[model samples]
Target: MKYTVSIEIAMPREEVIQLLADPAHLPKWLRGLVLHEPLSGVHGQVGTKSRVVMQMGKQKIEGTETITRREPADLREIPKGSVVHFDREIVVEGMWSVVRDRLTEAGPDRTLWVSESEYRFSGLLMRLVGLLMPGSFRKQSQQHMQDFKAFAEHGKDVREGKG
Candidate 1:
């Protein structure tokens, strides 16, 4: 399955990138995240692999996420009109996924974030879920983007249990 979701954040591109690149700020926006720790290399750097655990209601999903690409190693100075790219591959017991994210300046103080995700499932149960409920995956992705926008602009923390 493949789908793309996007949202506009009321923040500069650089500031958006900074927040997204920082592991310290992830839990604030990424809902249901239980733990994310680097297993090799540095967080956000190319080739870095991290263990990710997310809680979804009564289900717990654990996976390994590997950073495949990051353009302009330095996020401190991004030239105007240039887009920032972040790509990662995630692997779980019965599923493999790749997510490509792009960030561009929408205006003086606004950023546009686009995320494209693709998934491949192994095993009958996983494949059935993917085939039957593809919209759920896209909905989840959009929710994350919306959550991040809220966190970036209004300091809303998903862990706080308040919207």
Candidate 2:
């Protein structure tokens, strides 16, 4: 399955970059995130592999996420008109996935974030879930973007359970 979702955040591109790159802010917007610890390389750097654990309802899914690409390693001085890119590959027992994220300046003080995700399942159970409820994947992606926008714009925390 593959799908793309996007949202406009009322913040400068630079600010958005900083917030997204910071592991400290992940829990604030990434709902159900229980852990995101770097296993190798520097956190957020290209080639870094992180152990990710998320609690989705009654089930807990754990995966290893590897950072495949990060454009302009230095974020201190991003030139105008440059679109920031962040790409990663995730692997678990029965599924393999990749996500590509791009952030661009939408206006003087606004940012547009686009995320494209693809998933491949192996086990029968996993494949069935992917086949029967493909829209759920897209919906979850959009929810993350919306949660991020709220967090970035209004300092809302997903864990708080209140918008």
Show where candidate 2 strays beyond 4 Å.
none
Please provide TM-scores, in order, for all candidate models, with all chains considered together: 0.98, 0.97
Candidate 2 per-residue lDDT over residues 1-163, each given as its tens digit: 8999999999999999999999999999998899999999998999999999998999899999999999988988788999999999999889999999999999999999999999999999999999999998899889999999999998999998665
What is residue 40's positional error in candidate 2, in angstroms? 0.4
Show model 1 residue runs off by greater than 4 Å.
none
Best by lDDT: 1
Local accuracy of candidate 1 as per-residue lDDT tens digits, 60-97: 99999999999888888788999999999999989999
Query: How far out, in Å, is residue 19 in model 1?
Result: 0.7
Report, for every candidate in turn, its global Cα lDDT versus the true structure: 0.95, 0.94
